[model samples]
Target: MPTPGVDRWTFGVAPLAQTVELAARLRRVTGLALSLEHAAPELDALLDALAEAERRLAPLASADPAPRVGAAVDGDGRVYLDHSRHIGAFNPGFPEYEIVVDGDQATGTVNFPVAYEGPPGLVHGGFLALFFDAAIQHHNCDAGVAGKTAGLELRYRRPTPVLTDLRFVLTRSLDGGRIRSTGELLAGDVRLCEARMDAVQGDRARLPPVSPRREQPGPV
Candidate 1:
């Protein structure tokens, strides 16, 4: 079952999976572009090729991203694109991570690519916060419940390195009708960051249902 207020698809969605993979490759190219150096000497040809690709694609797609937001398509229970998901199964700019859930507990791994660097080879604190929020919500959804983020708090212990596999674990519990979750990022035995989040379990029944037939939304 898809988590309330968070998940829209549960993988295996036709074309959805394929598009996500393409987005990932796009991310990889962007990361490489950011880390390119003069020593590589291949940047000119790369940039030219990329520009040509963009020009070819420019007419096929819109520059505005709002269409994807709240857009609906039939898939695993009618996929609705929620660009805010930090896991970036769809969005290319968000932090990328893989998570696994077992009941209320979940564990995941993330490697902050070069494009996410902040203070000298370290992952940005802002991005780490985003990762935790997404991971926590992901756990909630997988646990058969979910909601909007009411509050999130993160503590940075040691600098989180970019391009290194970091482990994160989160546990969720119910506090009255609200959901509470806590998680940590670890570098081997060393703790890198910790997070505590609170979310209001919104009534999924009250949430708007997907409208798959609507065309792309335009400005009013």
Candidate 2:
């Protein structure tokens, strides 16, 4: 059986798999755009080609299909942002972090490329917060405290460097159905950031019934 929040569609959804691959390629392209030097005068041609490609692809927007599942919260058992297309996804368009769960604890690892840089060689602070948020959510779900984030607090201890692997761990507790979680980001033995988060228990009752079907109209 797959983990509760992990998407089984990862193996079966053709369009999603293709989209994930395309996003991975774009991430590499973004890193190259950020770190490439001007020794070669190819930027102009590259920009022109990108612009033409954008124009050619713009028409596909109108043809985009609606999502197959429309559950509002993760606990509804629908594939969503955390496992699908959001920045926190295991998919390639985002951090592409690897996570493991052990009881009430969750551990994750990620690497930031030049495209995620902010100050010189360091990772952006906002991205660090995003990482913590995702980690907390994963920990909460794995601990069986499914909910939506109500508040998040973060502290930056040092500059997180880019193009290097980083580690994060989260521990969670529950009180009155609210989840309280803490997470930390580290580089080897060095701590970089810390986070505390609170989430309210979601109402699973709002989710649609299993095997729901549209009512057919009778002949007039």
Candidate 3:
């Protein structure tokens, strides 16, 4: 049996894993089909199952764990971790993005999987942009703005490989009611992309309520 907070193979209802396996199998079978007609039905069924699984996992996938950054805010409007670990541990995998803040600077990292591949084994450019967007938002939050993306621009330098670590570094250029930030994504020593963003603090009344997810328990 798996300990608390560690993802383990459960006896039943391993929805995400099951769905991932099924999708992989479908992709393989469809690719090897002798004719287009032979693959269509299996492809259609795979798409339907994948869509349903994603719908069920969306909410859980979107939930943001109350980050432990010194300035982090919890779902109940409380501060959690006063200091955060490195970006890798901060945000593990999937559509999630992780930020590690130090003073006015932050770093983000995301590990793309085969599911997020774009060209062959490369990470999708759209997803790379999403990571930059989210990283900038987290940097803004660290700077005490509590705002959303008002504007963002990205320049892709090279293809980011799926299953490789993509790192982003953000520095606050301006802060106040409106925040201006600059950042970049690196694959190893090579620069993959660069970005800048502006975020304006929205009316508190118009802002959606925040409910932070609970942190997973660490090794004892």
* Top candidate when judged by lDDT against the true structure: 1
Predicted structure 2: lDDT:
0.67
Candidate 3 colliding pairs, count: 2
User: In candidate 2, what residue range of length 10 has the lowest lDDT sum?
Assistant: 7-16
lDDT scores for all predictions?
A: 0.74, 0.67, 0.59
Q: What TM-score does prediction 1 earn?
A: 0.76
lDDT of 2 by residue, 1-54 (tens): 235655222211223555666777778878887777664457677788889988
TM-score of 2: 0.73
Candidate 1 C-alpha error for residue 18, in Å: 4.2
Comparing 1 with 2 on lDDT, the higher-scoring candidate is 1
Q: Which rank order by lDDT, best down to worst?
A: 1, 2, 3
lDDT of 3 by residue, 65-170 (tens): 5432334433333323211122222222324456777756888777766656678888788877777766666555555444557888888888888767778788
Show model 2 residue runs off by greater than 4 Å. 1-15, 39-42, 63-93, 208-220
Question: Candidate 1: minimum summed lDDT over ten consecutive residues — where?
Answer: 67-76
TM-scores for every candidate against the unseen true structure: 0.76, 0.73, 0.52
